[model samples]
Target: MERIAIIGCGGSGKSTIAKQLGLTLDLPVTHLDAVYYDENWKPLPQEEFAAQQEKLVAGERWLIEGNYASTLPIRLAAADTVIFLDLPAATCLWGILQRRWRYRGGQHHKDGVFDRITWNFVRYIIGYRKQMRPKVTALTAQHAPHARLLTFTSRRQANAFLSEVTTSA
Candidate 1:
């Protein structure tokens, strides 16, 4: 509840959930995309990115949303809870489309962050369950076994969980 790591494919609502949970729990939120890329979409170097994540997780309470699987262990090891948005591929694709429409001008609601739809992003969403799930599952098991793991298979389910958290908070 205090320290959370949210992971899933693009458009899985990871940032949205992180914002909601951060508000409900009175914790700071970090949208990894905001930090990982500059306004012009230049990436932060890998070493610096990893170091920055290390500093972030050292805080007393935080909710970080991202799927940088390569740097996942840093957050996972520090999290008290891990929320995995495991919605179906079709649902994710639809979400991405809706997001693109919502932010049609390219700039995201997040400051200095831009949204771009690429073929690779679409293919990643389509192949996520088959390709990324196993890796994420294993990483969670290995790095955050003590953390509470919440996996939501649909948007409704994720919303319900958020409602529960809000009530409890």
Candidate 2:
């Protein structure tokens, strides 16, 4: 509950759940998108990004959200809890569309970056379950053996867990 890693596909509501959990648990929140991308949508170097993540995880408490699977092992090793949002691809596609419309011509509310919804992004979301999920699952099992792992197959389940956590808190 203290150190949490919220990993999922682009439109899988990782930022949303991280924010809610951060509020409920009184922990600081870090969006990996914000950490990796600048306001102009420029990316930080991979080494720099990993270095930044290293510093964040060294803290005693935080809720870090993103699906940068390459560096997942770092956070997984440090987190006390890991939440994997395994929502359907269609739902994730719809989420991206909704997010584009909601934040039209402006910075995204969650990450404060103006991201484009390109066809490649859509394809990535669609292929995530088949491509990325297995790797993420394996990484979690291998790297975060002692961490409490929670996988939600749908948004309803994720919200329900949030509600239960909030109420208990």
Candidate 2 C-alpha error for residue 47, in Å: 0.5
- Report the poorest 10 consecutive residues by lDDT, candidate 1: 105-114
Winning model by lDDT: 2
What's the lDDT for residue 101 in model 1? 78
Candidate 2 displacement at residue 94 in angstroms:
1.1
lDDT of 2 by residue, 2-109 (tens): 999999888888878988899999999998888888778789999999999999999999999988888999999999999999999998888777777777745564
Candidate 1 lDDT over 1-169, as tens digits, reads 8899999988888877887888889998888888788778789999999999999999999989999999999999999999999989999888888877777747564532346889998899999999999999999999999999999999999999999989888
Error of 2 at 116 (Å): 2.3
lDDT of 2 at 148: 99
Cα lDDT, model 1, residue 85: 97
Error of 1 at 71 (Å): 0.1
